[model samples]
Target: MKPTLVTQTALFIFSLLLYCAACPAQTAQPAPNQTAQKVYVGAYVMNLYEINPDAHSFYADFYLWFRWKGDIDPTGIEIVNRIEDWGANDEPFSDSVTVLKDGYNYNGLRMEGRFFHPFEMERFPLDRHVLDIQIENADYPLDSLVYLPDTANLIRMKPTLRLPGWDIEGCSLTAKTHMYATDFGNTDLGQEPYSNIVLEIPIARPVTYFLLKLMLPLIIVLLSSIGALVIFPSRSYVDARISLPIGGLLTAVFLQQSYSDALPDVGYMVLMDKVYLLAYAVIGAVVMEIILSANYLKRNKDTNLHALRRIEWYMALFLILGFLAGNLLLVFL
Candidate 1:
């Protein structure tokens, strides 16, 4: 027989109570474990490779070494060169991987790639530059990965290797944390920071190269053009004197353009540009000296000829000394 209304209501209440008792109470989720893995980073540059000042990029060949805990296979961890736009990955460049006596995993990566870097060309051929190699794990956040600089085996450029225009002075490594922001869809990830290891190789340019190739020619042309002022002012050689300084000015302009093409576009004038400006000034002075001396001679002023010649000597000396001083200041200061 069917139960009465009161009985049916009582049965329904009992079932509800049983369901509540069987189910566990809800609690907040535990926070994610933010434990970090220790990784040792080392690098050795085997080749200086190529440097493109116009493009503001460089190519380097180096052996990148890493030692990490064996508990996790860091092979999947992304290795990024922090200072450059180039990417490096595990591509079987190693002959074999080694397991350290301390139970750590070690691997060496043979990396040869082009990296974009902002080259400072204010000094140009006389400049010393620091080429940096930065590495980090892409997948692991800073809280999950910490890079330790391998000081004992720090990054070094081969000593025996000599670059044509550069000399390697020193090498060093530094450890730091890099902070990065994520996209909107990855807000749960929030702003992630990564472990970064940086290797710096300081290279210096021998001023001798610039002295020989650039400064020597400039000096020669300037001296020749200024020498025109010493020639006795005569109608026969008037055109020659004027043409000499003009030709020197044109030569200086050509040299400046050629050198500028090798440098990156910068807001301010470089030391080389300053030197070119000095050349233009000296040439202008020489041209004026020629015209003035010629005009004085044309007027047939024999009494003032010696005075004019003496004045030319002083002006020429000033121009030469001024050019030298300006170049020295730009190079040393």
Candidate 2:
């Protein structure tokens, strides 16, 4: 039978709707970034026992925890720490893995490992350094895996935690993408990328330790050298004056040697070195002053003895002030 025009129009519209629905409804393009895995990191530092600035390394005993949400088993995944000074002792003391029905993976361990700490020793004893414990995925590139700081689960020591000469200043956690080049022996690759999480602990050394151990004794010796100028004016007295400064000079040499044994082999001079140089100059000046003063006394200048005493006072004051000024410049500037 022949259909009317309106009925034919309705049938045409219905057919088109059915064909479109059958083909497929357009869905939002599956996000390209949905497959990326993010690993969360947390740590509790148990102890930091040894710190060797000369070696530029530190030892830390810590507990680490990792978590991620993924369908695949995380058991095969490896955790890498970039700050490892040596390859030995990288494994954790006790490691455990857990997988939940909801597709979450948890990994935790307690480990004591030696990590590398790059120290800034410009100020040496007065310097503050940030010690970093860095971790990342060894096998996965940044495209596949990333690390995040798990601030919720972070455990840290109090600021009171300190070594004999160091005080814990602060602590922080951060995560970022780290990129570097890999050498194939023949040529360098474009770039290799990894996700890094860093736990930073800042430590400071007290200035009083330096003052007492190094500066104080040197100051005492310098003061003792002044005694040379105050002694009786006799021909034999020149020997006493000479011996005083020479003894102080030797003591300074000994102290410097002992101190240097603990320091790194850096090329630049440090604050302590400057102080020692100043001390040596002062001692040497005193020796020279004593010689000149004794020669004047040998000329039977009893009247000029008072003038020599006044000169002695002037020399001591000048040396002391110069030492103080030099220290200020070295420390503050």
Q: Report, for every candidate in turn, its global Cα lDDT versus the true structure.
A: 0.75, 0.73
Model 2, 1-333: lDDT tens digits are: 356888999899999999988996674322213467877777777678688897788877766677788653232433344355454344543355676575667876666667777676768667888888777665666667766777776456634456767887766778766666553363554455666778788888887878898889888988887667667545676887789989999988998888888888888877788888888988989888887877767777454666667778877888888888988988889
| Span of ten consecutive residues with least summed lDDT in model 1 | 81-90
Best candidate, TM-score-wise? 1
Give candidate 2's whole-model lDDT.
0.73
Candidate 1 stretches greater than 4 Å from native: 1-35, 74-97, 181-184, 234-237, 264-268, 299-302
* Cα lDDT, model 1, residue 125: 77
- Over 194-302, each residue of candidate 1 has an lDDT whose tens digit, in order, gives 7777777778778787898888988988998998888766667899889989999888888888877877779988878888888899999899879877886788756
Please report the TM-score between candidate 2 and the true structure: 0.74
Error of 2 at 2 (Å): 96
